[model samples]
Target: MSSHSHDPHILCPHCDLLVTLPTLKYGQKANCPRCKSTLTMRWQEPRRRPVGYALSALFMLILANMFSFVNMNVKGLTSEITLIQIPKVLVADNYASMASLFMVVVQLIPAFCMLAIIMLCLPVRLPGRWNIRIAWILFHLKAWCMVEIFLAGVLVSFVKLIAYGEVGIGTSFIPYVLFCLLQVRAFQCTDRLWLWQQVSPAPAIHQPLKVGQSGLSQGLRSCECCMAILPVKQQVCSRCGSKGHARKKHSLQWTMALLVTSVMLYIPANLLPIMITQALGTKFTSTIMAGVVLLWGEGSYPIAMVIFIASIMVPSLKMLAIAWLCWDAKSSKKVDRERLHVVYEMVEFVGRWSMIDVFVIAVLSALVRMGQLMSIYPDIGALLFALVVILTMFAANTFDPRLIWDRSGTFENKEKFDDGQ
Candidate 1:
C-alpha cells in the first residue's frame, strides 16, 4: 500500500476510509486495507485489450442481430425469432416502456458503452470534455446492460420449449453468447483512474481528509463515480466531472418510495399470470407461485428452485432488507456496519436476477407462435412483474450505502484508517 506521506490519497467507496492509493504496475491491483474493496488496478496492454475486446464486442453484437436468434418447429409450421424482435414483440403488444427497457439492457446500452470505451481509448484525438462525457456515460451504463443474465434466462426458456418440438440454435446464438463474454471482459479492462490519468496525465491529487467529523466539515470528499478525492466545495469533479456529495440527498425518502412501490406491485407479480400458453386451444396461465408449483410438480426441481428464489424469495427478502436498513438508517459503531454494508452489497448484487421470470416470458412469447396451434403471450402480470423488478432495482440504487457508515464514524482519522493502524 502507498503511504499518504508519499502517494495520492483517496477515500474508499465501500468503507469510507481515507487511505493512500497505491500505483500499480501492469496486471497489479490495489485493495482497500479497511474493507477489501479493490481500489485500482492496471492491466497488461491496457490500451490494446479493451480496444480489441470492444471491437470484438461490436462485431459479435452485429452478428447477434444479423442472423436468426432461434428457430422453433411444430408440425410443418416453423417460427424463427431474431434478436431485434425481442423488443419489437413488446412494442407490438403496446408495452412500449418494457420494450425500451429490454432494448437498452440487451442491446442499446451495451453498444453505447462499448463504443464509449473505444472512444475513451483513443483519447489523443478526442477533447478532454468528450472523454469525460464518454467515460462517465460508460460508468453508469455498465450496470444496466445485462446480456449475460438475459442469456441465462433465454437458455432456460429454450430448455422448456424442447418438449414442444425441435428447437434449433441459430447462427447468432454463438456470437451473441461470445459477445456477452467479450463485452464483460471489455468492461473489466476499464480502469477509471487510469483512464483519467491518460486524459489529464496529471490529475489534481488531494491529501487525506480530516475525519472524526460529521457532514462536510472534512476537507476531502470522494467522487462516487471515480473515487477521485476532491475539495469539499467542488460541485463537479476535475478528473471525471461527476457530481460530488457529502451524502446523497433524500436517500431515505427515495428508497422508501421505491420500496413501497415494489411492495404494491409484488401482489400482482405473484397472483396474476405472467405467461399465458395456448396449446391446441388449451389455455394455461401461470403466476409466479403457480409456475413454481407447476415446475416442482413436473419434477424440474432445479428450475423450480431457481424460479422460486429469483421471483419470490429474492424480491421479498430484498424489500425486507432495504426496509430494515431504512428503519435503522443511522448506524452506530457499536452495531455491525460491516454486516450492514455486506447486506447492501448483496441486495444490489441479487436485485437484477429477479427479472428472470420477465425475460423467460419474453423469449417464450416470441418463439412459441404456432398460428393458434400453440402460442404464448406475456400477460398483465408480466408488465407488473417487470415493474416489481424495476422498482426493487431503483429501491436499492436510491438507498445510499454510505448512510450506514455515517453515524458509525467509520473514518475516524487518517492514522487509524491506514491498515487499521
Candidate 2:
C-alpha cells in the first residue's frame, strides 16, 4: 500500500491500471491489483546472475554446434547428425522455409537473446540509442527462442526412432540440453523493468497517480516496446520511439484476419502430407493425423498423444479461444473477465509450443538419412502447418487482453475524475 506520490508508477500492460510501485525486497514481485499481471520483480544480483548464465549458455551453444547431435544404427548402417546439419539438410532438400524456421527459432534467436542479455547486464557502455534498440529487439525476440521446445522435440524424436533401430546419445546432446537450461535461466534472471531502466531512464510524470486506477482514465498509456509510461496523447514513446495507441487499434480486426488465414492454411496443412518417408524402396506419405495414428498403432501412445496435442489440439483450440475472446471483448453482455484473462494468459503461453511438430519433422528429416533403407523428407504440408502456427501466434499477439477489462464500468467512471484527484 505504498501510495506515496514520489513512488514510481507504471501502467499495467494487461489491464492498463496505473499502479504505484513499492520498494521490493530481494526475490519479491509486484502484481497489478486489477488483472494480476506481474508489474515488476526484484531479483538478487540480477546483473551478475544473468551475465554468468548467459556466458555459460553461449559457451554451451558453441559446444552444441561443434559435434554430433544424435547417432542411430539401422541394421549395421549408421547415421549421425550435428546440430548445425539439421538446417543444412533441409536446405539441401530445398525445404528452405523449414530450414529457416528451425535455424531461427532453435539457434540464432536464442544466441542473439543471450548475447543481448550479457551486453545489457554488463557495465559495458554503448550509445543510448543502440542500447535501446538492442533491448527492444531482445524482449520482442526472446519469446520466439525455442531451444527448450527443440530439446523436447529431440526427445520425442528419440521415442519414434526407438522402434526403428538402436539410437544413442551424441557428444553434443548434453551440451545442447545444458544450453537450453542455461538460456532459460538467463532469461528468467534478466528482469524487463531493470534492463529498460538501465538503458534509458523512464519519462518524468508531473501529474499525480493513484494505485488501483486505470491508466486510460488518467490519460496515460504504456509503451509495449519498452514499458515506458506516457501520456495517451503521445503516440510515440520517447525512449524506444515505438508508435503505440491507447489500445492496439483494430486489434480484433487484425486478430480475426490472422485467425481466418490460419484456418485456411490449416486445411491444407492437415490434408497434405507433412513428411515423406522412403523405406525399402517404398515411399510413404504421412499427414498429421496419419502420423499420430501410426504412432498409436506402433504402441507409442505417449508420443502419439504429444503430437496429437501439440499439432492438432493446440492449434485448433487456440484459434477457437482467440475467436471466443474477440467475441467476448466485443459483446455488451457481462462475463467473468478474470477468467477470460486467465484464458488469455494460457493462450499466449501455449501458442509457441505448436511449433513442436514442425521441429520434430526437421529433426527426423535430418537424422534418418540412410539412403534407400530409410529417409525422411519435408513435404508441402510441413510448410503449411508451420505457417498456420506462426499465423495463430501472431493473432494472439495482436489481440490485446486489456480490451477484456476495458468494458468494465469502474474504468469508465474513472475517466471523469479530476486531474488533482
Candidate 3:
C-alpha cells in the first residue's frame, strides 16, 4: 500500500496539518484546518435556490389543476372532460382499493408535502412550539416528492394511450408543460440539506492555539480558488488560474420566472379534458371526474377507484397543501412541522404511480388493435392529461423542503461568508 494511503492522518486541504478521521464512510465529511471551514472533499453539498421560486411554483400548480386535457367525438356522441374527473370514474367502477392508494400516493400526499415546504420556507418566524412539527413535515415531504419520475411515466403511457383511442390535445397542456419546468426550477431553488443546516444550530467556532511545531500547525493556508496545497510561495491558484474565489450567487429572477411560469400553466391544465374515448361507434368524453362516473355506471368500480385517486384526490390535495404553505409563509403562523414533513414524504413516494391508469390504457391500446373497425387513437385530451401529470410531478420536484429555516436569513449570510473565506 502507498504510504499516503496507510497514513492514519490525512493532510488537511486548508491547513497542511495531518488529521485523523473517524471511519470514513461514502458520504463522510470533515473540516478545514486554517479556517475551521466545513469541508466535504469527496461529497458535495446539495445546491438550492431562493424563496421567490417557491412562490412561482405555487402559481403553476393552480394552472395545472384548472384546464381540460382531452375531448372525444364518435358517431353521435361527443364529450369534453377536465383533468380532475379521472380518479372518481375509476373508484366508481369498483377499483376503490387502487383509487384510494393512488390518491394518497400521486395527488394527496405530494400536494400536502409541497404545501408543508412552502409553509416552512415562507419568510416568517416560526413559533418555537411548532418547530419540531415543521421539522418532521420537512423530513417526510423529502421522500414523498417524486414529481419528475411520475412525469416520465405519464409521457410513456400517453404514447401508448393514443394508439387505441381517439385522443385530442387540449389548451391546458401548455401550462402543464410550463409547470414541469417551474417544478424543476423550484427544486433547484430549495434544498433539504441546506434546510437542515439552517434548522440545526451552528457549532461554536473555535480558534486553534499556537503549539510547538510537532507535525501539527495552525494558520496553514491553501489556494482558495484551486483548493491546492501551497508551500507559502504561491499567491494565485495554480489549477484554476484565479487569484481569489467567492461563493456563487443565485439568480433570483430566473428562479422566480421558473416558478411563475409553472403556476401560470396550472390554471389551464386543470380546466381541460384529460382524455376522450369512443367505443363501438359510440363516442364519449370524460374529464377526470366524469371518467369515474362512467366507470361507476359500467360497474368497473375498481378502475373508477384508481382514476379517482390518481386524477382527483391527489391533485386537489396538492393544491390545498401548496395554498396552505403560501398562506403560512405570508402569515408566519406556526404549523405542525412534523406532520407537514410526513405529508411531503407521502406526496413524493406516491406521485410516480399515478400513471398506473395511463399505463393500463397504454397496454390495452398496444395489444388491442383492429384497424379502422376497432382501433384506438390518442387525442388532444391525452396530451393534456399527460401534461397535467408531468407538470404536477415537476411541481413536486421543484419545491424545496428547506425553505422553512430561511426565515432568519442567517444561513444565507453564512453561506456567503463560507464562499468568501
Candidate 4:
C-alpha cells in the first residue's frame, strides 16, 4: 500500500471502508476486500491516456454528426437520415423526451466527454475547481453515453430493414463506428484516480473512525455525492460538499418508488408495439417480443438473441436483482453481504444499457420516414420502454449499497477483529 504525506487514506465507494491504495501494474485493478469493487486501476502512460484518442474521436464525432447516417430507398422514394435530423424528426413525431435523451447520449454527452478529456490532458494548468467539476461530470456522463450500444441497435435495425428495402451506408457511418471504438479505447486507457490526482494536487484526509461503531453512534458516513469518507457530524462533504448522509436519505423509499414506476411501465413496454412500419399504405406493428421473433424467423439468430437478452432478459434481471437486494438488505438475516453488494453494483451498471432498444427504434424511425410509400414510427411501447429504462436507472442510482453491509452486522464488529489474534 502506498501513502503519501498529502493523502493517506481513501474510502471504498461501494462498502465505505477506509483503505490505503496499493500500487498496481498497468492493467491491474485493486479490488476492495469487503465488497470487491475496483478501487484503484493502473493504466500505462496515464498522462497521455484518452487525449489523442479523444481528439480523434472529436473529429470523428463531427464528421459523424455532420452527414447523413443512412439512406433508404423504397420504390424509388428515397429518405436520408442525418445524425442531426434524428432528434429533429423524433421531436416532430412528438417524442420530444426521447429525442432529447437520444441527442444527449449519442452526441452531446460523448462530445462533451471528449472535449473534457482534451482539456484535461493539455499541457496547461487549469483552475482546480473547473477541472474537478469537469472530471466529475465526465465520470457520470460516461454511463449515460451509449454510443456503442446504440451502434449495436442500429446494426440490428439494419438487418431488420434490409429485408424490406435497399439500405445504403452513408459517408458518416465509418466515422461513427470509429468513434465508438476509440471512445471506448480512450476510457479503457484512462485511470480516473490518476486524472483526479493530476487535477486536484491537494487532498484532504477523512477523520478516522472505528468501523464497529456506526449509525448515529459513530460520526463515520460515506458522502453521497463524492463517496468520500466523512464524519457524520459534518453536514457537508469535505470533498464534494453534498449534504452528508448518515444513511442515504430515504434510499429505500426512492428506490421503491422508481421500481414501482418501472413495474407499471414494464407490461406496457412489452405488450405494446415498439415501432410501427407503414409500407405501400399498409401499417404493421411489432412489439418487443414480436420483433425478436421476426429476427429469429429471418435467420438472424445472433441479432435476435442480442435483442431478446438486452430488451427482455437484462431489464428483467436488473429489476429482480434490485428488488431482491432491497428485500434481503432490509429484512433478511442470512443474506451474504458481499454477494448483495456485487449484485447492487451489477444492477446499477446494467440499467443504463436498456436504452438499446429505444435507440434502435429512434434510429429506424428517423431514417425510414417516407411519406406514402414507406415510413417508420415509434409506438407507445417505445415511450414506455424508454421510461422503464430511465426509471430503473434512477432506481439503481438512488440505492445505497453500503446499507447492505451495515445490515449484515459486518460493520458492527470490524473494529474488534481489526488485529490478528
Best by TM-score: 2
TM-score of model 2 (CA atoms): 0.95
**Candidate 4 residue-pair clash tally:** 1
Which regions of candidate 1 fall more than 4 Å away from where they truly are? Answer: 1-7, 201-217, 331-333, 410-421
Q: Candidate 3: TM-score?
A: 0.40
lDDT of 4 by residue, 283-309 (tens): 999999999999999999998998898
Model 1: residue 263 alpha-carbon error in angstroms: 1.0
**Distance (Å) between predicted and true CA of 346, model 2?**
0.7
- Report the lDDT of model 4 for residue 99: 93
RMSD vs true structure, all candidates: 3.5, 4.3, 18.7, 4.1
lDDT of 2 by residue, 1-421 (tens): 4433333777889998776677777887877767777778888998999999999999999999999999999999999999999999999999987898898999999999999999999978896578888998999998799998889988888998999999988999999999999999999879898888888777776677765677788888999988888889999998888999999999999999999999999999999999999999999999999989989999999999999999999999999999999999999999999899998999999989988888888999999999999999999999999999999999999999889998784543322212110
Q: Is candidate 1 or candidate 3 better by lDDT?
A: 1
TM-score on alpha carbons, each prediction: 0.91, 0.95, 0.40, 0.89
Scored against the true structure, residue 277 in model 3 reaches a CA lDDT of 51
Write down the lDDT of every candidate, Cα atoms only: 0.79, 0.89, 0.46, 0.78
- Give the CA lDDT, 0 to 100, for residue 52 in model 4: 86
Q: lDDT per residue, candidate 1, 1-421, as tens digits?
A: 3332323666767666666665566777776654566777778877789999999999999999998999999987999999999888878878777788788888999999989888878746575477777777788777788888789889778667776788888999999999999999998988877776665543465443443343344656767776666677787887777786766778899999999988998987788888888998789888878877877887778888988898899999999999998987853435677787788888989999988888888888888878679998888998998898888898898887767766655454445422221
The candidate that achieves the highest lDDT relative to the unseen native structure: 2
**Over 4 Å off, model 2:** 1-7, 411-421
